[model samples]
Target: MRVMTKSALRLLAVPLAVLGLLFGTAAPASAHAALVGSDPAQGSVVKTAPAQVRLTFSEGVLLSRDAIRVLGPDGERAETGDANDAGRGNTTAAVALRPGLGNGTYTVAWKAVSADSHPVAGAFTFSIGAPSKTSVALPTQEVGGGAVGTLYDIARYAAYLGFALLIGAAFFIGVCWPDGARTRPMRRLVATGWATMVAATILLLMLRAPYANGGTLGDAFDLGGVRDVLDTRPGAALLSRLLLLAAGAVFIAVLFGSWAKREDPVERQDLAWGLAIGGTVVSVGLAATWAMAEHASVGIQASVAMPVDIVHLLAMAVWLGGLTALLAALWGGHRVERATVRRFSRIAFGAVVTLVVTGVYQSWRQLGSWDALVSTGYGQLLLVKVGLVILLVELAWLSRRWTARLGETAVRGRAAAVAQPVAAGRKGAGGGGGDASERAGQLARQEAALAKERARKERDGDAERTGLRKSVLAEVAVAVVVLAVTTLLTGTQPGRAAEEGAAQQASAPVSEVPEPLDVRIPFDTGGTDGKGEAEVTMDPGGIAENELHLLVTAPDGRAFDVPEVQISFTLKSKKIGPIPVTLGKVDTGHWSAANVQIPVPGEWTIAVTVRTSDIDQVTRTKVVKIGS
Candidate 1:
């Protein structure tokens, strides 16, 4: 009991250290669903309304009945039919447009489930007969941001954690800790894991709607939103997971209790077979639910990828879960058994090999190119995870060495224990003919020496156990980071998706390419007869918030110094009031405003006032087209 308490304290310390590192530099949540290209490409101007709206993603997507919505100038839905999957890999979704759909500008708001069952939603605008002065409001809330998104991600992380604990720990208790089956702590841990998963799944289900629509926390329980989620693949996948968990609970109880604690060999053998088959079926089913809703269910060679993914998840559960069980149950007691430790070492080794093999294949499939490891956010994160895994392997190696040492010590101690009793018996027999007092004295000395030797061996055993405990704790600390990274990785866009998107952008025709919103206007003021050019560049030159760069140059094209620079924006067609923008001077002799808000699509008149001298100031107005 003392050993258990001490080891639990040591185990608790590892995760606490890791939690500090995890939250200190946590990455933002990013979904895997990436927009590839759409018909009437984003921010495009078409002479006529197209027959349909088509959206393509990097991987396959499952759409809700209300998946693709086209809103015309009046903010009325223009889609005529349900959105359907199209193109190869079911990666494209298309919806018919109403005939003669008049548009100043049309917004396409869409919702879909990625191959990995994460729900994604986004909105874009396209125009008919040149860009319109007024367009339907783009869906600013397509993805839940801020608090709701945070909560949704938290739910996902919890689910992953719970699944690992429940599944892995149960496997350990059933396979390696039959003696511990009746322990209260072991049962309670398993129960806690199961309950956590249940709660997390429910939380996720509730958050699905708000996450898809970019709504507030209040919208989490909105019945309509929840209904919408249920209509989608991700929702169904979540539902299936719930069903599996519920069913598996019964078998989990059996495996951890009746089958594990049975004393009858024949009955135990039969129950073992039952548990093996029943548990395997349940595990594979649960894994399939994960695979069906994630990236492995879509993309290249999805058929092969799905099964590989199942294997990967199962391997993770076994390794991580088994480690937890070994630490909390096997090593928690007064004595750490050599046989149990050695058996687990073998099991852990196999799990590691499986993790490596499957991980490599998944990485290749998701990343596609070598440069992606450094080029994409997801790849960089994956690299970090891989580095931590490498560290974990080294820690495992250290722990393995300790296990070997423990095994050696146990063997030598047993031999010494056996030899001591035989030598003491010989001494007692030889002393029968000696003086009573002398015989008694000799026996007392032998007993004292034997007790001292036993104490020394006990101390040595405790020291080895302590060393092993520390190594295991360190390994567990690193595993926590690995799990966090994996959770984040699932939420991030695959590197292959990013590469594919870039290729699509690069392949577009020059005429169709978005023109840089870089404008240079030359002006002359009568006061000093000084001439200068004002060059303005707006990155992501659209009606959306943009970065504005204003550079002033003299007639000689040299950097022209201005006493003050003021910039303001107004939508002429919308008759909106001029919104004053403050600019800061940058080292490059340019005035910059990081976020220039252009609320709606129209001809935005950007008025830049530059004071060359206090008395010789001029304002230059440039009419720039901004799209919603």
Candidate 2:
């Protein structure tokens, strides 16, 4: 008992030490790349056309030649050359525009893989002179969506599941129940885990290109795409995982092969120690492949987060995966010793402690604030996971209770068996059989009764085992959901990044006015010349005095006159008034208003009323952002 306790303590010391080291150096990292700033900024107007458009991200991003696309007002490609890093850093991407571009609004569409390997995309328009009559349409699908995304997500989830199974089941057999390796069911479970890991990793490697590039499912088979992916950090991580898995295969072979066949106690002990050391190295290596390429590798204190994340992954596999192996043992009808179950229970408790400590730290690093926990999607999902984990811990407790009850029942059954044998011996001696035939008959009856008693005890034991099996099965089921949520959490934007972006926008300098608010509203007043469009423009569209212009154009591109035209602005967020603008006719179809005051910076509704005939007037409303 003393030795067992010491061994368990030794096993826990490694992760605990790692956790302590992490606490000293831990810092927050954005899980996904976000656009922090852009040149000719989003929705800004530049007097002259810039040589190139530059985009800046919160973190480093992996870019392809087609990562940035700039379209002219006519929806034609306006970029002169391919997108490049602009010699600034990996965190910036730029594309040169054609020289002497005509005056109109140009749309910029961008897509890039985050340093963490997930894809991100967005679109915005910037005008050279005035807002164009028509702007280029944006693509409906930006980043990860459609069939390719779904398959890639599935592969990611499967890889995590496979890692848990392979590492957990092997650990259970080696440390908890060595004899489990000889059982067909246990051996098959471990082998299945290995196969799953291999297949899922391969699928992920193939799907990485299409998943990041927004390509079709068929692109997964493109060798050229695969080669391109290999050139990136994420691709290299996947390849490293495969190599570690190869080493893992050899470990599995030795685990169920020669190790299971060993009969000498001394030799087996030595081999067990060697296997433990080797297995630890291989498992840590496998976990590092994910840690070094994903969220842990980017942002602040990455060197510490990487090792800490590795421990977290290993702990998760040990708890969830060991539960699976334990279930197989209970249902396999093999005689599982009480000591084996107890050993696993201790290990599971340690794993739970590690999970909680690391989970809290990770939550802090990703969220950075309490309000974000309720406001952000990533934070909300994390709450759901925490609730599920609480439920899982309850189920684990039930399994432990059943294990203890089974142990007590075994002890009572053994005591009853010993007492029964002595009673039979005393009865036979006292009878001293009057004849050889009578004595033989009496002996046969006693043996038959003993057999029946043994069968009754066996039935009771089976009932207890059934209870333990049910609880463990429940744990495994809940674990699957937890893993799925974890995979989704990785793909989501962290709350810290979202909050930072909001603060950045709120604190932007007021002096840097955005582009003018330009919108074209079509209307028909049921009159002969009323079926035209209204072109409205608000220059220097910010919280300051501005000039407003309104032009009424006929369907045939000719100026059309209206008897009366009225325009009003309303700030919905602040519940401000609908301030009216007074316009005077400058020319045939053009009206101008000088020093029109917009008192606030927010999303405002602009309502325009035009009267073609006295009773045939029409009104149209459009929303526009008034920058501070």
Candidate 3:
């Protein structure tokens, strides 16, 4: 037990050291492109019509011809040309607007593929002159949230599962137990994995267009849409995966066919080495198809992250997939050797170390800050995955313990067999037989004793094997949940991107204010000098700080002095507070305040109170629209 603990510590020491090194040098990288800013700005009212609409994203994007759609107030197409990068690189998309656009709100809906090969889309309105009711109708559901998306996500999950099984099972047979390739269960597992991969890849490829465009499932059958998807980066990656699977089919054939059939030890060793090298190459290639197109490829230090991601994926496949294969061997009533189990334990240990190191680096890169771990969806999901991994590791340790017990049982069984033969020989030589009948009786008693001992040893070995099999089965079950969570993680928006996009939106400046708000309120306190009008003006009246000026005048248009004046605002739509405005007397009958803050955009009720005397005061209210 002490030696096992020491060995486990030694195996962990290297990965921990490597993890420390990675953390020291690693930097945060943005994942999932976000719409950072735009030319007109969201919900802004401009006096002059801009020649073209431009959009800027946090990262590079791949634009289709109709990526940017500009709709006029009448729900008519307002854009004159196809969307393009406008020579500002792939991070910006723009489209020219039709000349002489009328004075009303225009809706801009955009859809583009991120540099990481995921689709992103949104819609916002920028009005000309003043805000107006628009005729444009937007989709109620978010992009990629309907039936087609569900099917595509399922296919993605299946592809990951299949890859894990094919690569992991193949590696297990080649390195842990070569004889396993000859077993019906192992062969079925590997073949099923390969077939699943092929089917899932094809489904994803066909559904790519509809998934990106947010179309119906029937759109997946459109030839033109499929061709369009084929021209994109994600489609290319899917195609590459299919091609690699074709090569993998050949590898599988060689593995269970000619390689399994070889009898000579020398030839088999040479062939095994060849298959190992070939299998590794194919596995790396298959993994690259994901690493080069997914979240790792578009972020900072992508060159470094890509290789690490590939290693991470391969390690995951070897551990989880190999566990399934090992379970099959133990439960299928096969005669599993001690050496085979020990070899797999070592391999699984190495795979776990790699997973830990790479997973840490990835989590850091995508999260950027510690707060994001619990605050963001991506981080929360990662936490769940980590918990599952810890459980899996505990189960793995239990399996290792059982493996050690099984080894001890095998050793004891061997010792008993050797001792029984030696004891029989000694007894036969030590005593001379007086008669043939006496000798036969003694031999019969010895035979019965040997049979009973053999049966006891077999029972002990079976008990240990049963314990190991149950532990491995538990690991397999936990591993399935881990994979499911991983698939969801791939689809989620990373925490870093979410935070950055929010910061960008908050910091974005409102470009122009079309008009200021001015209102006149008439009041009477039922006194000779109490009848007057209050002229209130809020300069640059938008969803921001503004200067407010108030002037009290008599019915004859001359300045009138009042004892006190108070003003307040309220937004009934959101049930916001009646925020009071502090005012000081600027001159006779005039009050002014700088930095009057309006919190949000909505129809606000502005109330004014005027006091001509201690006992005479009146309040008046007016509804005003505040722009964002």
Candidate 4:
């Protein structure tokens, strides 16, 4: 007994340690679909205006007719029509551009619904002929920002939880434990799951429009917005999920109806079989809705990927859902039967195996390589998820041990139950041969002894029930965290997207040299030699950290001397620091600063302050592009 207790404690320690590691290492990374690439790529200058603008994403995207906008140098809409899917799989969106807009820069602002139902928005610029200054602004926030996204994420998590509970509990009642149906609480749990799922689906549908368009909270219920959402893939998916849930409810009602009647075993057995088979079919179809609207439907060989993903979701539902069912219905009340626990244990084991197999396939497809696992943000999150699951598996092992103990105790209990009655009967009979009054007294004593044994058995059963409940609760707690991670992961970019982006960068024309920052700033002071040129040089400049060099030339084109030169950089978009850097006088006419870091990706303001004399200086600001 002590050895088993120690083993259980050791098992408990694994998930606790894993939870510590999970929370310690996991961070909230940027979520939303990744931009794979765009035509007339970021910061590219083309000699001719393209007919249409196209953007590709790492996952499938449902493009709204008005999702894409192209603005020309005149700050007017240059796009000719509404955006459309450029390909069949929902990965690309394109909008026509007005031709011959006379050689300037154009900005493309787009909004899209990713396969996982998250809204993403972004903007980039491309130039036709020489680049010209324009007033088109980039999107400040990704769609589904602030409270909307939080609420949406919560809804997603809830939906998953409800699905698991409803499906797992129904499955348990129909197949593993027919007695579970007799309990009102267990039946109510199934109803709660279905209701939760239905509520979440409706919530997601209502929020879909405002989320995708980056509109205000009030926009969630706009009649037009909701109608527009119904036209999209995500909305369709949610509707399908609701319909499936409704059908499932009917099946559950009938299946449990049989148990409620407490009919003959032969009739109940047939009903149970029908429920199991029908339930499996409905669940698979429901799982397909998720696959159709998520990462599973994107990427390579989606035909194969989709099925694997469905299985993965089902496996999760069975394992975690069953754990929740056990905690809620079985151990929470009367002591569960040994056979029920053993059946669930077997089901959990099978589910775990399925999880492993499907998870491996997903990792390979999403991560692509080992380097991605360590380097990419998505990969790092995957590691966190894997860690949590490993711990959950350990917790499962502990619960199985407790189950075995419960089985042994139950067997011992039955043995005592049978043995005590037999012994009492023999004692009464033996006394009967001696005297009639003695026999009556012996029988009375025997009845009291049997009552005492029954009480003892009940006490033992309670103890075992308490032990089992504790194990299950601990397991459920860990499983909830795992589900949270899975939810977060759904909205995050895959490592495959990151790798493709890197590959695109690598394949860019090496022959194309980086443009240098050659700004000639005119400065003036109180002195007669005030009017002069401060020529600044930044080698290999666009977006990279590079050295800064300054050379001062007088109005007469002679070498002009400056007392001190300093530079300040500010990234207004990100509200980054106005980092100040002082230049060292290198020679008669020059000053330089080496290895200056830009820090973030975007346009940065570089201001140069040159002092010609005491209290005599001029500061010049110029915007420069920084690389990602």
Q: State the C-alpha lDDT per candidate.
A: 0.74, 0.81, 0.84, 0.75
Q: Which parts of model 1 have CA positions greater than 4 angstroms off? A: 1-33, 69-90, 94-109, 132-144, 223-231, 407-461, 506-628
Measured over all alpha carbons after superposition, the RMSD of each candidate to the real structure, in angstroms, is 13.9, 10.1, 10.9, 12.1
Clashing pairs in 2: none
Please give the lDDT score at residue 168 for candidate 2. Answer: 98
Write the number of the candidate with greater lDDT, choosing between 3 and 4.
3
lDDT tens digits by residue: candidate 2, 397-471: 778777777755554564566466556655665655467547756775676578557744664556667788899
Q: Rank the candidates by TM-score, best first.
A: 3, 2, 4, 1
Give the TM-score (vs. native) of candidate 4.
Answer: 0.69
Instruction: Judging by TM-score, tell me the better candidate of 3 and 4.
Output: 3
lDDT of 4 by residue, 1-628 (tens): 4554565455446544544454344332212356667887866777788888888776667777778988886789999989998895777888988766777667778888777666777777777764555666655655777777777888888998888888888877776777778777778888888899889888888887777777777887798988888788788898889889889888877866755575688877777677778899889988888888887776666789899999999999888888888888644443367888899999998898778767766766676666778888878989999888777777777778778777456545655665666667666666444586577566767775775567455644666666777888998999889889998888776777676656655554222224667778777766656678888887656443477888889888888677877778899888996998778888887888887666655888877787777878788888877542
lDDT of 1 by residue, 109-162 (tens): 888767676666777778776444343656655464678778877887777777
For lDDT, the strongest prediction is 3
**Higher-scoring candidate on lDDT, 1 or 4:** 4
> Which ten-residue region of model 3 has the weakest summed lDDT?
506-515
lDDT (Cα, tens digit) per residue for candidate 3, span 39-120: 8998777888999999998789988788899998789999997999965558888999999998777888999878887788
Residue 290 CA displacement from its true place in model 1, Å: 0.8
Best by TM-score: 3
Model 3, runs deviating above 4 Å:
1-28, 137-142, 408-461, 509-628
Full candidate order by lDDT, most accurate first: 3, 2, 4, 1
Residue ranges of candidate 2 with Cα displaced over 4 Å: 1-29, 408-463, 502-628
Error of 2 at 479 (Å): 0.8
Report clash pairs, candidate 1.
30-491, 115-294, 116-293, 116-294, 116-295, 117-293, 143-214, 144-214
